[model samples]
Target: MFASVFVVILGLLYCRKGSSQSFLGRPRLYGPSEALAKEVVYFKCEVPDYAGDEEIYLQLFKVGDRNRSLGGYTSLRGEVGAIPKVIKPSHEGYLECVVSAQNNSGITPTVSHPHYLKVIDPVKGAEIIHSDPMEFYEGNALQLQCQLSAGTHVSYKWLLNGQPVSQSPVHYAADNLLRIDRTSSKDSGSYMCMATNTFNKTTVFSSNSSEVVVTIKDFVSSPNIAFTVLKEDSQNYSAVVTCESTRGTPPITFSLYNRTELVTNMTTDDRQATFKVPLVLDRHLGWLQCQANNGERIAYSDWLPLEVVPAGGPVTMHYDFDLGENYAIVGLRFYCKVKKGSHLRYQWFLNKTLLQDRGSFYYVANEAPKQSILLLSVGRSSTGTYHCEVSDSFDNTTAISSKKHYLDKDVLNRLPILLVAVVFGCFTALILLVSICCCIGVMFRRRQYGEKSLLNLEMDTMRAAYEGDLDLSVYNEDPDVVNAARGDEFDHASEASVDE
Candidate 1:
């Protein structure tokens, strides 16, 4: 029984080896069945229970061209199953692979199902296809298309003025076509189309179409004017007036009007025109309007009223001081008067030198129309001529005081000397007049006393001769002696009076 069991075990082992060999006769390829051009493909034919050590071969060929082998491998064995085959297909078509196995007994081969490969080339060119009408009008429907000559799976994108044409309520983009429900002047620009291969989005292979200029024609509308005031004063005003149309074509001319007459005419190749109105007067203050013309249509702006008033006169300046005073002393006040001006500016000058407001010696006392006074704490250096200048802020018209007043060394210094000189002169004249009156009185008195004195002297001499000793008696006795004595007395009296 033991011998019988051994023989049975050997028979079962042979049956198992035969079953494995039968399955190896047909090998199945295991790899990617579909590939692209220039794509590396790896494949291996697998056989169940076959050792890796074997003589095997692999062959690759296109379908329906079995005679022309694209590639192949040699010296493959069943122990090695089927050698892995690597291939890179150059063209797009169906491809097939065959694996052959060889051993000491024989050789067997098996073919795999065909593999489909796809190759792609980028888009080479693109163009914007024109519609029926080359020109568009405002509020009109329009459509544009992009035409491309490219490989499979190509896509299109539209651009306007180098920006993407996005879908909106009025614009629609479907596939390679763009539609506009309503067009306007804003839609007038260069339109372009771009074609790209979607198969390789990362490769960035795209073609741009030639720019197509779309002209949009429309009537001028929404006429309006804008004003920028450059300068404003009481007399005149300067401004920049601009006329514009919200929607219009180029070559538009603008005309500015004051009341009914045209003031200026301007031509522009744009939608708007600007004019600089310089030194506009009160007469130019009426209703102003502007119009725009584009050789086909004319649009007018609403009337804008402009008003200007007259400016004030130049500044007039004057100096006020005490006329009776000879010199300005310490604690003296003077005034600068500014008149006939608006927005006046004041400056004080001392002997042609600018005087600062802040100083210890001088300061502004009362700044009023009547005053504008300058007070001084007199110093030796304060003795100089002073004047003031006034200017109008608006017109820059300046005026300086005609009278320049001055301070001098103290008034007291020369006043006493002058008073003394005047008093001395008057006293001298009074003395001379009194002396003339005295001389006249003396002459008259001398004449009157001369006669009276003669009589009085004779009486006195006779009295003396009687009262005295012999001399009196002798004078009373003799008339001649008495007359002589009287004469002598008269002479003495007259001489004495003359001397007095």
Candidate 2:
């Protein structure tokens, strides 16, 4: 009985010893590496459960500041424990987790490896900025910067046309800045920036900057000038001149010149501009030329030769129609012409009212002085009888009017053919009249030659019969000598007749 009691005591001692054992391995601390200031941070501590029935307590604190605990979690079941703490800028530093178990053997502590908590300030109100001239020419350098109101550990990237821009030979992207070494037309687009911290990659922070438009302009190219003569006279010439550049940016300044004299200049947002130029003979207008300037460069067009042709003669008017599908008349064209005139001024009268610039409904194109056109929309006041008055630009009083004619496409089509036939008949009659005049002239010359030959023969016979010391060849060569010989013979014949 004493031996059995001693064995029971040994078993009880072993059970007490086993109940006081400590945790086996160190605790593992898990948390975010970086966190925004004034944000809630969670730390998890996982400890090995050596004695399952023991109470476990975990503490999270900075490594160097072991005196004060940041947060704590307790578990009676000895499971994974988590603690949350409000992290501030002051809380940025190294942190660690310590877990302890309390049992019959008192408390045992196991510390985890140090963890780094980098508290950061989020970026806000990001924007893109640029300075100096807003417009850049080709081959010019461009620079832009990303700016933020408040941030920490900030990084920047550039975006163009909503796509991420990578570094290239001509394009450069660095922290907070983007640059183009040499700008071109293709480089023109919208530019933006994104400013963020490393935490934004996995966090809810965003710092996209507002977009800024970047413009790259093209240099002005050599210009060319073209002109259509509207009217001309002995004193003045009028034309519509166009100045153009094949390739260039807008807001171009175009200047028209008559030799060295500047006639006019215009500033337009397009690459081409038109000017109405009127030249005078007294001023001695020379060749017309044009110049284009885009603030970066200047170009000039080749000289254009311009001359004046005076207007003259019988004025006539004809009509034609621009037909659409199904032979529908969409537009009407009235042509006023002068048979022998150039640089003529033309005016059209509908009933009696003058049609001067009646909005877009009417267009007047005097391509040449001899031929002026009045184009009209079919339904826009194109009805009624039409007559055209024309004259030289120098003299309006000499203007002549053509007979009024009602416009009917079907009737006018046959009118042109009839007019052509009439013109042909007049030309043929002129040729016939010239031939008849030539025949009459030949007959008169032959009759005069026969009379002179008969007179010369009569003089030769009289000289031979009389045998006088005078040269009868003088009578044939000189008409006055032959006339005197004829008078003497006629007087002798009168005497002989009187005696008979």
Candidate 3:
């Protein structure tokens, strides 16, 4: 009979182990699977279908020390199965529970499966660490580390510009570190790190570090210089020199040098800087140079020589015209320049009268310090003599004027006198020719009709006075020739009358 009872008990135990559902008197433990270090956690062990008067005890122990209870609860009627525990680093292991009851079953104990209890230290004072002088050059490596003052089982993630850093081949994140193998100008902005740890599968604690500013700069190329010369007087000059780089970052330092001696230096957020230099005659200015730097490298521009030229020389003037399809002048321009001068002033004149700069009719175009151009739209009003006067800025006493240029040879003032003189000369010559012809006619008449009588001349003179077509007053200087012609006419008339 005892053997049969023992076999029955063993069969009952085997059946309970094989079933998917827990037996009626078995205990089930429920609580948080993980807790922070030094935190309080509660564990509840419930036994289904227990009587009120039964005495129950809930025992907690580590999985490896199941024979000894670390802490327990004792109560009658199985009503005090709720247990409290303080989690510590020493308690970081699998935990288990056993519930024993004294009732009709007489001190039967049910053991639960192991529950993993992860003990973690809460995160505090999270921060991001990087090298000093948070400036980097393009194509260089950058490293960042996320750290916490006290934490366990922590995870790290990187953020840029308040957003998650996108995954790329150049970006790496592992352990507590983030690395960028290749950096570019686009990588410049605010950077931060996030530290997190899982309390349980459903709960997480996180802390964010303060943002850090990172700047990426590009290497500067070779520098270049541009300069302009302005003459202040005959012996003094000034120049404006500009230094620039085509491709580089800002906050660049530009240095100007005269040979090996530094003239001046300037710092600006732009890529270009300007400087002023003075030049004096009879004094050496030295070779000019420009240099650029941005904390990474230095670059230099080509050297330039500084020389001062005096503002005096011979002044000359010339003209150019544009013609239309019909060969008519449409536009005219007069250019006046000095052969060699530095700071010369120019003035234009028309017909010895100073010309004012007026639009379209007359104006000055491209009026440089040493050269000037007078532009005119071809018209009757613009037709006149024009000239230019050039002088230095030292004093108004010394000056030079160009030769005269005339649009018309006979100006308005000389036209009438030339016309009257030509007319009077022609009139006098015509009267002389008439007098000479008369003299020859009279000599010819005297030689042919020398025997003619004075009585025939008196009769013809009376008849010619009656004929109005012949005016005998014109030959008053030679009275004999007039009388000879009249006598011939009278003889002809007398012979005709006789023949009739």
User: Which candidate comes out best when scored by lDDT?
Assistant: 2
- TM-score, cand. 2 vs. native: 0.45
By TM-score, rank the candidates, best first.
2, 3, 1
Per-residue lDDT of model 1, residues 321-434, tens digit only: 333345533455666655443234466778998777757678765453233556666668678987776644334444545367766756523567778899999999999999
Against the true structure, what is each candidate's TM-score?
0.34, 0.45, 0.44
Q: List residue ranges in candidate 2 displaced over 4 A.
A: 1-23, 30-34, 38-120, 124-135, 138-141, 147-285, 320-333, 339-344, 351-353, 356-370, 374-385, 392-395, 398-400, 403-500
Select the stronger candidate by lDDT from 1 and 3: 3
lDDT digits (tens) for residues 370-398 of candidate 3: 57999887777788888888775444555
Of the two candidates 1 and 2, the one with more favorable lDDT, higher being better, is: 2
lDDT of 2 by residue, 1-500 (tens): 99999999999987766555444468899999888887897889987645567677789989978899999998787778889998877788889998776443355577999998888888888998888465779998898888888777777878889988878899989888888898888788888898877564676455998788888899888888876555355444667889999888888999998899999999999999999877553243579899999999889999987654445566788777787867677788888887765456788888876878454567878766548888877663566778888876656766888889776545533447778999999999999999999999999999999999999999999878786666565446577878999999999999999999
Worst 10 residues of 2 by lDDT: 228-237
Kindly report which residue stretches of model 3 are placed more than 4 angstroms away from their true locations once superposed: 1-26, 32-39, 47-57, 61-70, 74-80, 87-95, 99-110, 114-123, 131-142, 150-221, 245-253, 257-287, 294-296, 303-500
Q: How many residue pairs clash in each candidate?
A: 14, 2, 0
| Each model's Cα RMSD | 29.6, 26.7, 23.4
- CA displacement after TM-score superposition, residue 309 of candidate 1 (Å): 3.8
